[model samples]
Target: MAVKSDFLVIGSGIAGLSFALKAAEAGRVTLVTKMGPEETNTKYAQGGIASVFSDEDDFELHVRDTLEAGAGLCHEDAVRLVVTSGPERVRELIAWGVEFTRSDNAASNGYDLHLEGGHSRKRILHAADITGAAVERAVLAKVAAHPRIKVFDHHMAIDLITRRKLERRRKGKDRCLGAYVYDTKSGDVEVFVAGATLIATGGSGKVYLITSNPDVASGDGVAMAARAGARIANMEFMQFHPTCLFHPPRGKFSDQ
Candidate 1:
């Protein structure tokens, strides 16, 4: 039997959950995660989101810092878009109940922004040390309460069902219909038919022997996309350890 919905979302990380929460406003959403939604890479992010929320920070400076950090690999358009919209988008997270840390009455809003290594100013808004966990919890709570959203845990998407798979390889841009999902618990494959499908599985950090990313971050979604002929590139680039330089009132060598 085929399960149908307005949107089929794979993976239950921040990306997947965020998209589903918004998409559910207009139509029904069916979200599937390979494992329980709580075991996501998003919770591992200790550092927090970067946005221009302080008096000293601005979009251009943030964009420049990001471009410099990327070492010329980041797309300029993408950088600009993210930098400009970052504050607003992060505010949306706040609206969704992400309790970003707050301190120092220096700023008007009183957010405890951190001076991350690459940034020229203090802009990283966090939730103490478990920033990602806080974000994930907030979004997950909202997603759970949403009436139009249905969640399926322990379901892995094996492959995307594209138009090419349905019909012959004719021309014109082929569209995606849904995916073939495998239920780990039931040990059966189900066809998910949706008007739109989104893949939000996190990075492939588990490819390495020793990694900080959880075992579930095995890049399965990337493989699924590649198998579906979705142009995959920049495979060489990988983040060994996303740096977050912690600097308290004093130094790192000794506790002041």
Candidate 2:
């Protein structure tokens, strides 16, 4: 069967869902997820969004701290952009219905920011402990309510439909038209066509024998993009957190 949309998004995490919501205003959007719509690594994030929210604290400090944390390899232009635009992103999140905890309590009426290990100030905005869950929920709710957005659950992409599939003679360039997807319920192949496509599938931690990631974190996007002539970077580095609790049976943590 053939399905059509103006925009097609593979993965329903924060990036995919947000792109779908934005594109829906102008055209039809089809969002496909491997399992349930909410099944994503974003829902499991415990850390908060870092942003300048206090008069005492400023953007320069946030930028410097982020650079320091990123080490010498951090890009100067990218760091500056983040530091300057951080506050606006925070305000945008608030306008989208994200409720951040207030920082000062009775003394002041503003966002209560926390400091991560790399952060220089109390600039990380959070909601109690599970900040990412809260932000994801808010964004998902709004995206779900948008009539232009259509979500397909339990659909997995088998492969991308490219120019080579059409026997094109082009040597250096290949174009992505759509994808061949497998419908788990019916056990049949479906072709989804879109003018624009976005792949927001998260990183692969499953390739490792042990990780804090979900079962679906198998580097699908990276593999797919690589096959389409995209370069892969930083495949060798793996950061191990000493604070990561590893039990015999439990992978990462116990129910809080």
Candidate number achieving the greatest TM-score relative to the actual structure? 1
Task: Score each candidate by Cα lDDT.
Answer: 0.89, 0.79
- Shift in Å, residue 112, candidate 2: 0.8
lDDT of 1 by residue, 1-256 (tens): 9999999999898999999999998899999999998889998888999899988778889999999999979999999999998889998999999999888657726899988898999899999999999999999999999999999999999999999867767466799999999999999999999999999999877676556776688899999999888899899988775553433424322221
TM-score of every prediction relative to native: 0.91, 0.89
For each of the candidates, the C-alpha root-mean-square deviation to the true structure, in angstroms, is 6.7, 3.1
- Looking at candidate 1, the ten consecutive residues that score lowest on lDDT are 247-256
Query: Any residue pairs clashing in model 2, and if so which?
Result: 102-112, 103-111, 103-112
Which residue pairs come into collision in candidate 1? none
lDDT value for model 1: 0.89
Prediction 1 TM-score vs. true: 0.91
Q: Model 2: how far is 108 from its true place, Å? A: 7.8
Q: How far out, in Å, is residue 166 in model 1?
A: 2.4
Top candidate by lDDT: 1
| Candidate 1 runs further than 4 Å off | 168-172, 242-256
